[model samples]
Target: MDATPPGWPEAVRPPGAPDWERTAVAWLFDLVPPDYRAHEVLRRYPVLLARFARDHVAAGLEAARSGWRTVRVELADHLPADAMAAAMTAYEREGARLAAAARGVAVVSAALRGERWVPRL
Candidate 1:
């Protein structure tokens, strides 16, 4: 019953992957009760988000990194049935893109640092 969608193996970390929790915001997610987590990130982490956004903007950027600010919108419940489905499609598309990009960047960086293997053809 693994509900993971297809094309997600790129993002799934292998078992026993080195822990990075101390260096990332994923820990902020576990603070929310699962049933109540859906709309809680912005409400709970506004300070952190604001600081990050400010830092991103001060770097002479007009928008937050990766479009963070507009990511938390909540559409009214009155939308047509297809609206939620469309949203899900968009979310999935972005999620896949981000995951793939992260994997690509990490591998490239590791290779540059002599950590990832580079095969000769």
Candidate 2:
């Protein structure tokens, strides 16, 4: 456990939470797509918000039980050994997929809520 929270923005720390960073981080991974723009998702996809929350929380709990180390090992085994560029490309694509999903959720949420001023990502 980190004594001092790392890579946490001062803004997102919940008020009166003892472990704000941990709380926020767990929120990001466990909740609907943890990012600064997630608030936008809340604004747009009003209908799916409950579903996303339920599924995401379940996934988070399962991931915690399984542990990250095992997941990392599985990911490593699937990477291309011969072509470094291909491996990098695959890595980038997967990251983009996650980002796109987050963006989609945010955009849909915002539209549903009829939000006017969405902050720039």
Which candidate comes out best when scored by TM-score? 1
Score residue 26 of candidate 1 by CA lDDT. Answer: 38
lDDT of 2 by residue, 50-112 (tens): 347545645544544454325445566665665544555555565554444444334333433
Which residue pairs overlap in candidate 2's backbone? 41-106, 43-109, 43-110, 44-108, 44-109, 44-110, 44-111, 45-108, 45-109, 45-110
Please, what is the whole-model Cα lDDT of each candidate in the order they appear? 0.39, 0.44
TM-score of each: 0.36, 0.33
Q: What residue runs in model 2 are displaced by over 4 Å at the alpha carbon?
A: 1-46, 49-80, 83-85, 118-121
Candidate whose lDDT is highest: 2
Error of 1 at 13 (Å): 24
